[model samples]
Target: MAFVYDLCVVGAGMTGAAAAREASIIDNYKVCLVGPAEPKVRKVNTGKEVFGAHYDEARIASSTSSKVPVWGILAERSIRRYSELEHLSGVHFYDSVGSLTVGTRNSEYLNKVEKQANSQGYAHSMDILDSQQLRRKYPFFNFSSEDQGIAEENTAGIINPRKMVMAQISVASKNGCDVIRETVTGIVRQPDGNSRVVTENGRLIMTRKVLLATNVFTEIHNLLGDIRPLYVPMPQTVTLAEISPQDATRLRNMPSLKYRGYGEPSWPSDYLRNNNDQIDFYMLPPVRYPDGKYYIKLGHSDDILKGPLQVSEMQKWYCGEGDKALEEQMFRLLQRLLPGVTFLSHHGDACITMVTPNSQPYVDLVTPTVGVVMGDNGWAAKSSDEIGRIAARMIVQSDWSYDLPKHMFKLYTNVTGPPPASKL
Candidate 1:
């Protein structure tokens, strides 16, 4: 008898890996995951190549959010499960040194974050700190008198995102998931209603259902038909600053920090402070890099690299170091936050993040046999597990499960209600 995969997940990044792994938990169906071995070489929009978002070295994981209430809940659930997942997978990726969101006193953004935490029933996990307290607790940080801190009490820090994806895929493979490391060329529907997944090397894999977690490439393949129009791809960059091991120790206990800023604008456009005036900065504690030297990582809180791009443009951005001006600004921002620390050298990587019309991700069943988990809005690293869980539940069961607030993540419902007040 020929082997037919019960579920075939394309794009084994964070979301695909998690979805495949979660779905594999059920012993009833044979699952398979397909993705590119090297994402940078993958062809995307306009038939050109671009780098994958998960190719980054690290990503921040925290429960604090100034967006919708459900965002925090999803993040909190995933954050709490990091340890258990690490133990089960025998892979250590989560570095739980804690996290902090620092903003000017009376800042509207900070107020919203507090409200979000309260609504999610995890307010106890957060603590407010005045400028004096912030300086006293984290001496390595340089905070202004007007700044205050929202300190997350537990399960917040930097995560090795690539390794986390590997861990998920590893665990899923061990759970009997067939791992296919290849690019999906096309997905065609069969006469009997099943889907046939075609790979780059002219191979056909039959699957009962298909989950497209291919991120921005969803558009490249037109996976969702009309629904695919809802996602927009934007370039994202992160810079790493090499520092001495002594400086790393000095800032070792420093929590993952988000520096919030507000400009003359009466209103903020996007959630992550992605504006010319309201540009925000985020930092992760120093970690040893491949060169055996400790390096601190930083990136803009704003989706500063806005607008759509062709595959060729994205490929150029990924294969090369990011914008020099942005890197300079990032360095200045970091130096301002920690004046005592000195960066010996700087390096960074560029990738793409798919944004929805709303900031929420699309983790819903597009058709009876087609489910999608895309448009992470740059939050996939921390929340991929929950997003994957929702997708897996959809693939396993005929209806939505009560384990998560599935309705909030529905793509069609979100786009029809109202356009996002601001660009994501």
Candidate 2:
């Protein structure tokens, strides 16, 4: 007789791992986490290979958001637990170097961020810096005269997404949750109120309930049967500029940056045009990659593929190098942002963001026994822990027990022309 799991999570990425761990800890349920490991070698046109956005070394983690106050709330909830998770799993993934947000003084975006910060009581932890103060504090950056900054000097910094996932999975395994390293190909809804998950290697597992954290691949494999959640899988390009160890040490105090609005007027007009006249860019300080080199990473959140990429295009996009022209623009922007910073070499990588209608994550159950926790909208890396917790409680207790309203995460099914405008 096959052992039926109390709950089975269908993605082993950050959210899925956190969900599995939380579910096991909540009630000691028989939990199973399923997903393929990162590809050892990223070769184009490979067979059945899947990728996740958490394969990087550094992601900005902060309790300030320009979109909604709820995001800051979620980030604060997760940031408070980084130490506990690290200690329990014996993994170090977070760095408290701080995070900085800059935009024109009293700009609409900065105002929204300040409002959210105040609502979340994060204003006290942050230092508001005028353009002159910013220049004095961080002499390395080249800020426009009108730019004002809000610096979160504590409780905000960077997280190693890969290591964070590992930490969650490590603790989950210690709690007796089974970890399966295989790609989930399909899910069969049994006649009874249960599910049978089928993997690519011809393995089957039965579970009382299912949670899908599959992100962009949620609909690609038809895991939800005929239910198609409205989402746009847009392609993103991230460029990394390798710097010397001396440069890395000299700039070790650099904080992760979120710069709003078009930068220096000298920047290429085509790049600005491609980004829809918006030049908002987020950057991570020098972080060592797997290749044993330190690189400064930067990417414009709005500079993405024009139309929503189809499921067939994802694999190819992931395999091939990202847009070369965009990469050049990012590298040039990085050079301008940090003058006199020389680079050994630079290259581009590809990733995808799943944007939903409301720019919020969907943490609701599609069916009584099937739940979904996806649609990151570029904010999942920082808030994944709390998001996962909400989903786990929903699955384990079989109720909407979270403080936030359930309708905020309500799932939208079928029919959509283009995703609604995003707040981020």
Q: Global lDDT of each model?
A: 0.76, 0.87
Alpha carbon lDDT at 297, candidate 2? 96
Task: Locate the minimum summed-lDDT window of 10 residues in model 1.
Answer: 263-272
Off by over 4 Å in 2: 265-270, 273-276, 303-305, 415-424
In the predicted model 1, the residue pairs found to clash are none
| Deviation from native of the Cα of residue 31 in model 1, angstroms | 0.2
Residue-wise C-alpha lDDT for candidate 1, range 1-424, written one tens digit per residue: 5568889998888889999999998977799999876544433343444246777566778888886556677778888788878887999998888889988788898999888888778788788999899889988787777788899857788888888888898899889999988778788898988888988778899999999888777655555555544656777767788899888887778788887765213222333456445558778889886568888888876457755766447666666666666776677667666778988998776677776777787777877888888877877788888888888888777568756566567764333654446523
Q: Using TM-score as the measure, which candidate wins? A: 2
**lDDT (10s digit) by residue, model 2, range 124-214:** 9988899999999999898888889999988999999999999999999999999999999999988877899999999999999999999
Model 1, residue 167: displacement in angstroms? 1.3
Query: Which stretches of model 1 miss by more than 4 angstroms?
Result: 39-50, 225-227, 262-276, 403-406, 413-424
Question: Candidate 2 lDDT (Cα, whole model)?
Answer: 0.87
